[model samples]
Target: MNNWKPRVSMGIPVYNGENFLREVLDSLLAQTFEDFELIISDNASSDRTEEICRSYAAKDKRIRYHRQEINRGPAWNFNRVFELAQGEYFKWVAHDDIYAPEFLAKCVEVLDRDDSVVLCYAKTKFIDSEGKILKEYDYQIATDSPQPAERYRSLVLVNHRKHAAVEIFGLIRSDALKKTPLLGYYARGDSVLLVRLSLLGRFYEIPEYLFFNRDHSQRSVKEKQVQIARGRTIVAKFLGMGPLPPTEWFDPSRKGKIDFPEWRLFYEYFISVKSFPLAVKEQISCYLYLGYWLFKNWMKLVRDLLIAAEQLVRASYKAQKIIEISLEKRF
Candidate 1:
């Protein structure tokens, strides 16, 4: 009897997110846009997450809940939701974020009107755990530029401290999004996803601030704090002037491995440039922009190498200690 099709499919990937899950579900269910389907992918949460999702799904026909048998990383769960989506327009909703009632209606309107615009999002404000607005994201990227290279360049040199590139959470044409790798299991993979998407088509940002990003201790970017609490790391000791980026948050399997996150960004950006079908001049311009990026991030690039060497050395020492203990036990 279920023959209804939705114009938009929204997916929320979550893990142990009981604290804010109810509020997010309420906001989406209240949205002015009624044709959208809501998909929740639970990453094997041990909390009351299952109970909450099941209860919501029971009440709403639009809500679909899928629980993982085992916890993969956030990136894996993010992709899982997209795979399950059947709508023309797709949105990856964060478990902790809130949206205004008109958020989805406005985005779908823009996408419906313009074929060139591949993604549409509203301006965002950062909110604290108590739902108080901390500040608006005033950072601008010329994402609406008609030229692909110009859009790509605008996203490449972002002041991440000021701009979160939250547009990646926006409504995107499923076809355009499918062209780029849907978020990778590497650090800063979400950033790469936005940058690459800019090459495919223009992005539209609604003037009003309709997206509210939640900032709390449980957020993934703050997962570094948990790592720091365990002990000092090669990245913290040798790398200069920053908190450790959340590698394990993207993929828990990356824990204790030697990772060149900055280097990976450089590689992926280069690949994005090479793979796209842009004019020769625009392609050259994109490469020049990357050169500028390397000039700015050369220090971090070097740090990646240093951190890798230190990690390898520590891993070797640990392995040697284990072998010695094994020999003593045998004797």
Candidate 2:
């Protein structure tokens, strides 16, 4: 074991995950790759999460545990873990999820063998709270590593339909990730970060189910909603067809309006130059998506409103019945 080479750092961010924490840590300890270090960053967990992590740290020399003074939120905690990582490759392990034994070994092998591939994610199995077999999830797997243009195009159209970004299966180049810090953007930070990762290099997919993602009611719906909204904004920005402004409006040098990457630039290019056909295609795709989305969301809003109305009526009916029964008893 002393001769083992630590090529990968497995980062697991925990916050009040006491119930499932030990199981996750146990899985990592049992991994076939024995040389790696497990960096467990506890984000001020109020439960026994800290105790469990400390116990594991005492037991295993490779387990490095750090508890934040305050809760930095999930995104910040995740970023802290990655920034703290000191390995050639990094993998984000969710506090509640479990991994197959060969996950690390296989992922490391992929990154080790391939210099061009910067990311490699595999199929995941959805498990219940008790770790029971639920189902295999392979729907998010994207087969080909298309050019950046095609990648953005597919991302705009189909990213949300894919797997959880939190699973974070890829073996990331530590150097490349340091360039794209995961700032707590409202939504789609993961998507934007993935875009940054893609810009660094290509991505590969493992053809097996080596990760287990837990599905339960405790999932954060607010975060998901924010992610969806951010995804829409990103896609719209890319499909808009004009050069992107700098990373932010505050940065100057190329100020006002500079040509953005063609892969992500909006249709404003043809509009500015008065090229009729190209401008029309841009306008058509942009508005068609806009209209389709508005109509779709409007219909969903109407359905939700109707359901709320039904629930309100039912509650009112129950209240009236209770009042009538009380009056009848008094009479």
What TM-score, computed on C-alpha atoms, does each candidate reach? Answer: 0.94, 0.66
* Candidate 2, pairs of clashing residues: 240-266, 240-267, 241-265, 241-266, 241-267, 242-266, 243-260
| Cα error of candidate 1 at position 112, Å | 0.9
Relative to the true structure, how large is the alpha-carbon lDDT of every model?
Answer: 0.87, 0.63
Clashes in predicted model 1: 0
| Worst lDDT 10-window in candidate 1 | 226-235
Kindly report which residue stretches of model 1 are placed more than 4 angstroms away from their true locations once superposed: 226-231, 243-246
Scored by TM-score, the top model is: 1
- For model 2 the local lDDT of residue 78 reads 75
1-331 in candidate 2: lDDT tens per residue? 5654467888888788887888888888998988788888898889999889999999998888999988766667777787777788888888888888888888788888888777777677888889987888755433245444333333333435454564355678887777665533223456556655654566777788888888766665444553344234333344442222222221222222322222121222112113222244544553454344344445433433343345467668989999999999999
Candidate 1 CA-lDDT value: 0.87
